[model samples]
Target: MTTEQLKLRSMIVTALFAAIICVLAQLIIPLPLVPITGQTLAIGLAATILGARYGTISVLLYLVIGASGVPVFAEFSGGISKLIGPTGGFLVGFIPGTFIMGYYMEKTSFTFKNAMIANTIGMFIILAFGTTWLKISADLSWTAAFAGGFTPFIIVGLIKAALASWIGVLVRSRLVTAKLLLPIKPIVKEESI
Candidate 1:
C-alpha cells in the first residue's frame, strides 16, 4: 500500500479508538468532586495499538468532541464547561498519556517488563499534567491538588498500565506474526539489469 493509504488507515483507527474511549467514559463512578471511568483503558489501548503522534491526536479529537456538548464525557456532561470543570485536569491528561505510551512503544521491545515500565511512565506524565492543572483550576495548594487528582486513580492507573502493557505486547506480536500491520517505511525495489 501507498504511504498515504497507510497513514489514512492509521488515522481511521485512531478516531475509532478515541470514540470508543468516549463511550467508555459514560460508565462512571461518582466520587468526591471527581469520577472514575474506564476511559483510561481505552487510552491505553489506543496508545498501544496506534503509536504516539496519532494516538495523541486521537485523544485530542475525543476531547474536542466531549467539549462540544457531545454527552460523551464521564457523568454525561459536555461543552467547554466540562473542560473548565474540576475533573478537567484528568480529561486534559489523556492527551499526553496517549502520546507518551504510543511513542515509547514504537521504539521499544514489547516485553512485558519494558512495556509495563513505559506504560507506567506514560501514566505518570498524565498525572503530572493533570495534578498541576487541577491545582490551578481549583485554587488549591500543590499537595492538595495532587491529593485530589492523583490519589484516587493511583491504584487503578497501575492496574490499567499492566493491562495495557499486556495488550500491547500481545497485539503487536500477533500483528507482526501475521503481517497484518504495515511497516512504517515503504518497501524499496531493487533494479536488476
Candidate 2:
C-alpha cells in the first residue's frame, strides 16, 4: 500500500479498537471503589494488535469520547468528573500501560508466552497508578486503597490479562496471514556516500 493508504488504514484500525474499548468499559461489575471492567482486557488486546504508538492513540481516543460526556465508562458513566474521580487514574494509566505492553509485543515476535508477560506487566503498571490514585482521590489509607483497588480484583485481572494476550496474539496472527494488518517495520538507516 502507498503511504496515504497505510495512514488511512491505521486510522481506521485505531478507531475500531477505540470503539472496542468503549464497549468493553460497559462490562462492569460494580465494586466499592474500582469496579471490575473489561476495559483492561480491551486495552491489552489493542496494545498487542496495534503496537505502542497506535495503541496509545486508540486509548486516548477512547478517553476523549468519555470526556465528551459520552456514557462510555463503567455503569454508563462518563464526563470530565469520571476522569478526575477515584477511578480516573486507572483510565489515565491505560496509556502508558498500553504503550509498554505494545512495546513488548512489537519488539518481540507475537507469542503466547511473550504476550502473557507483557500483559502481566501492563496490569501491574495500571494497578500501581490506579491504587495510588484511589488512595488520594478517595482519602483512604494505603491499605484501604489496596483492598478496594487491588485486592478485590487480583485473580480476575490475571485471568483477563492472560486471555487478552493469548487471544489477541492469535487474532493478530490471523490478520497478518490475511494481509489485513501490516507488521511493524523497523526504521532503516541510509548510508551517505
Q: Find the candidate with the highest TM-score and give its number.
A: 2
Q: Candidate 2 residues 1-193, lDDT tens each? A: 6767666777788899999999998898878678899999999999888889888999999999999999998888899999899999999899899999999877776888888989999999999999999999999999999999988877998999899988898888886665557777535568999
Off by over 4 Å in 2: 185-193
Tens digits of per-residue lDDT for model 1, 1-193: 6667666766676778778888888877777756768888778877776677777887899999989898888877789987787778778888877887776777764577767877888788777877887888889897798777888878988998899888867876675455544443323567999
Return the TM-score for each candidate structure: 0.84, 0.92
Per-model C-alpha RMSD:
5.0, 3.1
Clashes of each: 1, 0
lDDT of 1 at 17: 76
lDDT score of residue 104 within candidate 1:
73
Cα shift from native, residue 61, model 1 (Å): 1.3
